[model samples]
Every structure is written in structure tokens, then in C-alpha cells.
Target: MTTSALSAPPLHSSAHDDNVPNGEDQAQRAAELAALHRAADAGEEAAAWVRQLAGRQGEEEHGRLLERVAEAIVKASSREIIPGSDGLLTEELRYTLAADVVLGASHTTGTLPELHPGERMPLIAVCSIAATLPSCVLGDLVREVEVLAAEMEAATDAGRAAELPAAG
Candidate 1:
């Protein structure tokens, strides 16, 4: 599939305005456009990889998910959620695993998982399973996170949740 189909429509036009005094604005806009295009291309690449891994009657849903995730990662790359740290381009996903399995509604939480930069294969596998299987991918992820939280005191079970939703 084309990269344009995978990426989002630009929020603003990159056309140059004559009224603008300097070329600074146009230059910045050009840079942003370039970055966005690159990200879109990357997302497409990732989606293709996911589809190839899934095979013949591929996991179409998960392939699309990767496309969206890649695009979002490119946009949010600058925010630095884990300040001063460089790793997976991660952000809180859309699916909510648990609202309040044990705690009251007020204490509801999630398990936010990070996609390390070097660990794309595992993620692709997880997403593929999520897309094809009629199972709660988020639940499994939450359980894994709970285990990690136990091993590493720094991790929190109730606070962070990763949203790896099935292909709908």
C-alpha cells in the first residue's frame, strides 16, 4: 500500500505565503513536512512487515494498527515522555484493559508498556496475535506487566497499562 494511505492528512498546507517577511516559516514548515513523510513511510514499512509475518490470510487488523501506531510515534517522538531517556517510541494506547478489577472505580488504572527501539519483532508478534485471536491482548499484557512490576519495584501495576487492542 502507498504511504499516503497509511499516514494522516496534513493539518496545514505547506504552501509559501508572499505576505510573510522571511523564509523562516516556510523552512520550518518544510522540515515538519519532511519529518511527517518519513514517519509515514516508516509506518507503512512496519505495517508491511507485520502483514508478511502474519502470512496468507494475514492479520489485517493488526497491520492497520501498526500503521497508526507508527504514525503516532513519529508525531510524539519529540515530546520525550520518559524525559532524557531514549528507547521505544511509546505512548498510552487507545484500548483500556481494566477499569477496576479489584480497586474501586476511583482507583481504576492501566498497564502502560513501552516498545523498546530494538524489540520490534516481539511487538509485531504480540500485535499479530491480538489481531487474529479472539482473546484479550491487553489482559495478557497487563499480567506480564504485573510480573515485571513485582520483579522491579520501579514498575507500578495500577498506574501503567499498554493498549494492544485486537483488530476490529
Candidate 2:
């Protein structure tokens, strides 16, 4: 799977520069905010996709998938991180973040956003979960979900085919 790099918006720096113009700083801040909004939107879409995939499975199968996800999370989290890497997030943190999103999205009520109380997680919520994660992690998470979805679909189709009477 191709890992697409996601550019996160720059965090606001506390230091004030006397030499820089105020207007330019304001414009830059606005741009950064826009980038963050875009990232949040992307994260929400990814969550929805995973939820859909989970919805296709039976209860037992869904439970199995969740188990697999848990196992994956544990494995991913146990890996050692390289010292002084350029990545803003470590592999463990990324996996944990992705797992949180995936688990929340895969909840039974997570597919529908219109319900009051039980509503699917809002974009803001998803953004909060993904705020620190880089785009590559989201991309990887989506790719893995897609693979699982495909496998589930194929298995379902095969079962159906087996149930049908053989063509005379």
C-alpha cells in the first residue's frame, strides 16, 4: 500500500517577533487553520469508511475483526522508535491513535451521525483523536481497513456461491 504523506498544520508559536508585520502573521494563521480543517475532514471520511467495512460483518466476524485490530495495536505499539527521527509521531503513538479512531468508528451506532446521544462521532471528535497524527498514519489505517473489507466481501461472496444450487 502506498503511504501518502499528510501535511499537518503548524502549531502556533508563543514567541512574538517584533520585526514581522502583524498582517502577514494573521494571514499565515488563517492558512494554518484551513489546513487543520482539511485534515479533520479527511480523518472523518476515513473513519466512516472503516465503519462501513465493519458493518458488513456478522457479530461473530465483527468480534474477530476487533480482536485482530487489538492484536495489531499491541504489536505496533511494542516496536522501538528510532532516536531523533523527523517524524512528529512515533510508530507506537500512530498505531494507538489509529486504533482509537478505528475502534470508535466501528461501534454499532458509529455509522449514523444523525442520532442524538448515540450519533456517530462528529468531525470535531474525530479531529481531536487525530489532531497529532500525520496523514501517513491515516492513509495506512485506511488501506488496512480496505484490505479487511475486501477479504470479508470475498468470503461472503464465496459462501453465497456455495449455497446456490449448481447450474444444470
Candidate 3:
């Protein structure tokens, strides 16, 4: 019974009839959870990356965002929407912005312009929403939405990663 073995991080051990051959369940469980915690903490780093990218949207971007928010609000509260209703206004903005970010990141911009509403109007509509929201809320909202987009991309990447085989 060496001290190093006792103090060492436990290996992946479990009584699931899969990996564990002989080990204390307590140590196994603790190690599994610790690994999970580390992954969770790594996610915070991913979130920070998102926030940093979002925060750099710049003044011209903010102004454009504010104008979009305003127009979006008016169109949303309007009695008669010509082609699209304001009912899904906010969601549309989030989705469209997310889509734009995705497309821009992937460099597939000219392929698709609309993320929601099934049309190319979201780009036009989002600029409307940014115009409607208050100044303080607008930039934060932009950050929030951009962060959401990045999260979406991260999730997709994670999903793709999950399907990969374990390291040798």
C-alpha cells in the first residue's frame, strides 16, 4: 500500500460491469465526478471566449444593433405586420444573429441569409430589433446573443467530438 497509490487520482473505475475489475466504488465515483467538474470548468473558459468575442463588436456595431432593436420593437408591437408578425420578433433576432455569426465564422455567408422565418428577411428584421431595445440593453443583448451563437457552435463541435473514438 504505497502513499502515492492512495493519494493518486483514481482511475476510471465503476461497478457497471464494463470497466471496473476490482476497486472501491467511493474512489471511482469521486474520480468520475472530479473529471466531470473539470469539464464543466472548461466550459466556463469556452463561455469567456464567447464573451470576449461578443464584447469586441465595436461602436458602429452597437449603433447598428440599437437601430435594429428599435425597428424590431415597433414592428413587433404593430397592429398589422405586412409579411411577418412581431410575435416571434426577439427569437428571430437571436436566431438570425446566431446564424449570421455561424455563417460568418464558417465563411458560408452568401449561401444562406435567413436563420428563422424561413426567409431572407431576418437580416433586415434583426437590425430592426437592435434599434428598438434601449442603449444599455442593446450591447449586452448583442453580447448575450453572440455568446448564445458561440455556445451553439461549441455544442455542435462537442457533439461531433462525442462521436469520436476514445484516445489510444
lDDT of each: 0.32, 0.39, 0.36
CA lDDT for candidate 2:
0.39
lDDT tens readout by residue for model 1, 1-168: 456743545455545745433467667546544543433343344434333322321334433444554443233322322222442333253231111111112222232222323334344333322222212123332233233223222111111122233357
Residue 98 Cα positional deviation in candidate 1, in Å, after optimal superposition: 13
Model 1: residues >4 Å from true position, as ranges?
1-21, 56-93, 96-168
TM-score of each: 0.30, 0.34, 0.27
lDDT of 3 by residue, 1-168 (tens): 556875665476555756443556666546544433333343334333333333444443433333443333333323211112232335665443342442332342233211222222333333333323222123333343334334433543443344356789
**In terms of TM-score, which candidate is strongest?**
2
| Model 2 segments more than 4 A misplaced | 1-21, 59-87, 96-168
Write the number of the candidate with greater lDDT, choosing between 1 and 2: 2
Model 2 vs. true fold: TM? 0.34
The TM-score of candidate 1 is 0.30
Residues 46-130, model 2: lDDT tens digits: 4443344344445544534534433332322222111233424555445444524434434664442222222223322332334
lDDT for model 1, please. Answer: 0.32
